[model samples]
Target: MKQLIVEIDETTEARIIIAAKTAGLSAQQWLKRIIDEKTVSSWPDSVKALAGSWQDVPFAEELRSGEGREKTY
Candidate 1:
């Protein structure tokens, strides 16, 4: 319910109009949807499952402590 004014190149403006028409949305609505998609962030279930998964991996603490890097350099 807020108003915004943005200046875009003619080519970009044309592309937005075409895409919005193709998607059956107004250009304003299309741009708002695009912004909403990009601005929201959430971790997926698969990634959340990875939490603490590394704890049981062999030598995880050694690797995290830079043991290999000290030996190589």
Candidate 2:
């Protein structure tokens, strides 16, 4: 594991400590979780689980079929 050194103002450091405490995590754990969330490349599980959930919504192809679009000259 690599060690990271950051220089933050006292107020910011206090805020991070407070936030970590509120989340029931150490500052390091909270920061690691935040970094992981920020660096993620794929959709989170909660969002992926929403796929095919909106049965009434039109698909991309249906919306692009130009059914109600105005004709151009």
Candidate 3:
């Protein structure tokens, strides 16, 4: 197998570690499984605050109905 080197930020490295632990795997194994096209056993645990009011029931319903969902960043 060919060896590859990847450079990432510290935050990303931390996330990788979290993801690896979530799947009960080492970082190398996690990356290898990803490269092998296996489904990720655990998702990365990052939370983002969505823009919405607590009482915005209508807006929440609209969002859930696929009315105002963003495709991606």
Candidate 4:
């Protein structure tokens, strides 16, 4: 695996350390988890589960089809 180097202020470092300790992880593990979350390639399960839940909402194609729109020109 490749390695990364970062520079953070002391206050930020202290905060990270404290959060890691609270979560029972080392600073590196906590940071890695955060990076993974931020860089995820797919929608989260909670968001995906919301699909088809709104029946009244128009799909993108329908909204852009210009139906019922008043022509100004």
Top candidate, metric TM-score:
2
Estimate, for each residue in 2-48, the C-alpha lDDT of model 1 and write its tens digit.
78889899999999999999999999999989998788798778889
Q: Give the TM-score ranking, best first.
A: 2, 4, 1, 3
CA displacement after TM-score superposition, residue 24 of candidate 3 (Å): 0.6
Candidate 1 vs candidate 3, TM-score winner: 1
Tens digits of lDDT, candidate 2, 1-73 = 9999999999999999999999999999999999998999999899999999999999999888997889899
Candidate 2 Cα deviation (angstroms), residue 67: 5.6
List where candidate 3 sits over 4 angstroms from the true fold.
38-73
The alpha-carbon deviation from the true structure for residue 31 of candidate 1, after best TM-score superposition, in angstroms, is 0.4
lDDT (Cα, tens digit) per residue for candidate 4, span 1-73: 8888999999999999999999999999999999898999999999999999999998999888996789898
**Would you give me the overall lDDT of model 4?**
0.95
User: Candidate 2, after superposition: displacement of residue 8 in Å?
Assistant: 0.6
Q: Candidate 3 lDDT, tens digit per residue, 1-73?
A: 7899999999999999999999999999998988776665554444224434356466655667865667775
Q: What lDDT is reached at residue 53 by model 3?
A: 36
Clashing pairs for predicted structure model 1, backbone only: none
For model 4, where is the 10-residue window of minimal lDDT?
A: 62-71
lDDT for residue 45 in candidate 1, whole number 0-100:
86
All candidates' TM-scores?
Answer: 0.58, 0.72, 0.46, 0.67
TM-score of 3: 0.46
